[model samples]
Target: MSKGVKTITDAEFETEVLQAEEPVLVYFWASWCGPCQLMSPLVNLAANTYSDRLKVVKMEIDPNPLTVKQYQVEGVPAIRLIQGNNILASAEGVMGKEKLISFLDTHLN
Candidate 1:
């Protein structure tokens, strides 16, 4: 299921996300974050669930400097649903499944 999701790097951030033709859900996390470990499955599920309307991608924050700073991502387990340069919605830390789905559905309609 998560195989459909792409693990992105800062180098590919521009072409893969910022230039994407459709809305993108960018999940920023760190390998050492405990909540991030728990949130991974939820993120992947969201990727598969919203595949038709979203281009879901995950980025490891520890190694990705440019995007971490550019997006003002100050912590792990962060999500930014964006289209082009506009961030349609965003969330930090962890959330419940229903809330997560609700967050993704915000602008997809």
Candidate 2:
């Protein structure tokens, strides 16, 4: 994970994401997922580029089942854009850096 990205757990989900002052981009992934691995770099890039406007967090689904269940994440490389208590947008699968940036930009603006 990059310095701009934070690794969060189920216990910290509410405070880190739900109660965050800025918009949060939560990456729901598992260590064993190949697609998640592929998407990691793009996520990291987004984290670095959007550090000022967004809070990027990675949540390993294997250890954080409660949050995964709550979000109904059936696959790895799932991303949720959350602001305050609301989920603004969500996407699944591996995305390119441009697409990921566009995803965030759409909701951020």
Candidate 3:
């Protein structure tokens, strides 16, 4: 199966996310972050569930410093919902599948 989860970088952030035709769910994470690691599977599940509705993109905080700083992501496992190049809502830390879905719903619809 294709891993719906993708690691986005600074260069691709604009075209791949900000300019996306559909809404975007971005998970800003770090490999060494405990919460981020724990939330990986949940993020993947959300990606699969919402694959048809929104784009689920993962950005490694360490690699995408520019975007990270630009977004002011101060914590790992920060989930940002973006549409039309604007951040509608965001939250940090681990999120279960249900809560994540609800959060997405609040922003997308």
Candidate 4:
């Protein structure tokens, strides 16, 4: 886990994400994915930047298959913005910092 980001597992998904008080930014990644590695920094930045309004969590796809399947996350570097039982927004692949910010602004605001 990086600064401002909490590592979450499949078993903790419900308690940590679905039950969160604020919107949660879920970053789905895997150890062997290059794009996942590339997006880590941007995700970390988002975690810090939106700490007050958002809960940032990282889920490794391998160990968290339950959540991955539940979310229909078919690829690495997937991003999902969820609040309560609703999924507000989602995307796949690596996104740059600016694009990431724009995406958050669109869904979060």
Candidate with maximal TM-score: 4
Ranking by lDDT: 4, 2, 1, 3
Query: TM-score for each prediction?
Result: 0.94, 0.94, 0.91, 0.96
Query: How big is the positional error of residue 51 in model 4, measured in Å on the Cα after superposition?
Result: 0.7
Residue pairs in collision within model 3 = none
Question: Which 10-residue window in model 1 sums to the lowest lDDT?
Answer: 1-10
Candidate order by TM-score, decreasing, is 4, 1, 2, 3
Give the range of the ten consecutive residues with the poorest summed lDDT in model 4. 1-10
Candidate 3 wrong stretches, greater than 4 Å = 1-3
Please provide, for model 2 over 7-103, each residue's C-alpha lDDT reduced to its tens digit, 9 standing for 90 to 100.
9999999999999899999999888899899998888888888887889999999999999999888888899998987889999888988888789
Q: Model 1, range 3-109, lDDT digits (tens) per residue?
A: 36799999999898999998999999998899998889888898889887789999999899989898889888999998999999888898879899988776788
Candidate 4 per-residue lDDT, tens place, 44-95, comes to: 8999888879999999999888899999999989999999999999999988
**Steric clash pairs (candidate 2):** none
Clashes of 3: 0
Better of 1 and 4 by lDDT: 4
Candidate 2 steric clashes:
0
Q: Which scores better on TM-score, 1 or 4?
A: 4
